[model samples]
Target: MRVEYINPFVEAAYNILREVMHGEIKRGELYLKSTSMPVLGVAAIIGLAGDVQGRVLVDMTKDTAIKVASTMLEGMEMEPLTHLNDMGKATITELANMITGQAVTKLHNLGFKFDLTPPAIFTGDNMEIADTGVEALIVPMILEHGKIEINVAIRERN
Candidate 1:
């Protein structure tokens, strides 16, 4: 992965977390392999195409997800993830969507135009994305209230 692409995502994450959850996110090493499956809690996956093609998975544990949703809903605590309701999915998906939309716009000004598909939220341990030919950039975010990770499974076309 290019240092260029990685930095943009980092900056994007910082902005998104600060705006969405009103919290600071500390980033860590990449979880590059598929062995990292059975991801915890809720996950939102958005596919990107056009100039960049790959899958972006944003995940957070159920507790943190609820905390985030609560924060988004204007300082109200949500019911636990055991409920597994639509509102939770909407909040998480919207968060992922917002992050991707901002990132795409930034990339456009840099001469890269990428199209992002609608985000889908998955629960439990069965969700997966087929492996892509190119190496994917994995970013792990640790937030005070939750986790926000972005998997940039896209590579620049030759």
Candidate 2:
């Protein structure tokens, strides 16, 4: 909800993505969603709790996921994936974790204490996410492989 909260995630996503993909990373305009919104096929979600509570979703199409995963794997000198298999899913999940971990570190330095759940990957044909009472702020990062949306929905705990 707060711009203060969103900036770190956006910065982290940009920094990590640029480093990992080893390509230009373009950030799109920020947008808000308060109602149910469709996901782009594959999503990696991380839950946050402590001073702030909610979740962050790294969302993208399956094709994009495959491309991203392949790029990441290639960087590690591992075989690139042709599809969203177990290794591909794990690669995406780790990407989400790295982004969240960096963002959380920044937030912690700013005095926001929180814990993050392990990243979870969800893939399907048609998927929608609705977070009651919390508005989600989405930052779209466009890469050579494809686009990934970093969706942040968090608020101070009562």
User: What's the TM-score of every candidate structure?
Assistant: 0.82, 0.98
Judge candidate 1 at residue 21 and give its lDDT: 70
Candidate 2, residues 77-146, lDDT tens digits: the string is 9999988999999999999999999999998998889899989999998899999999999999998878
Q: Model 2: residues >4 Å from true position, as ranges? A: none
Leading candidate by TM-score: 2
Q: List the residue pairs that clash in candidate 1.
A: none
Segments in model 1 whose C-alpha atoms lie over 4 Å from true places: 34-36, 75-82, 126-132
Write down the RMSD of candidate 1 (Cα, Å).
Answer: 2.8
> What is each predicted model's overall lDDT from 0 to 1?
0.73, 0.93
Cα deviation of 152, candidate 2, in Å: 0.5
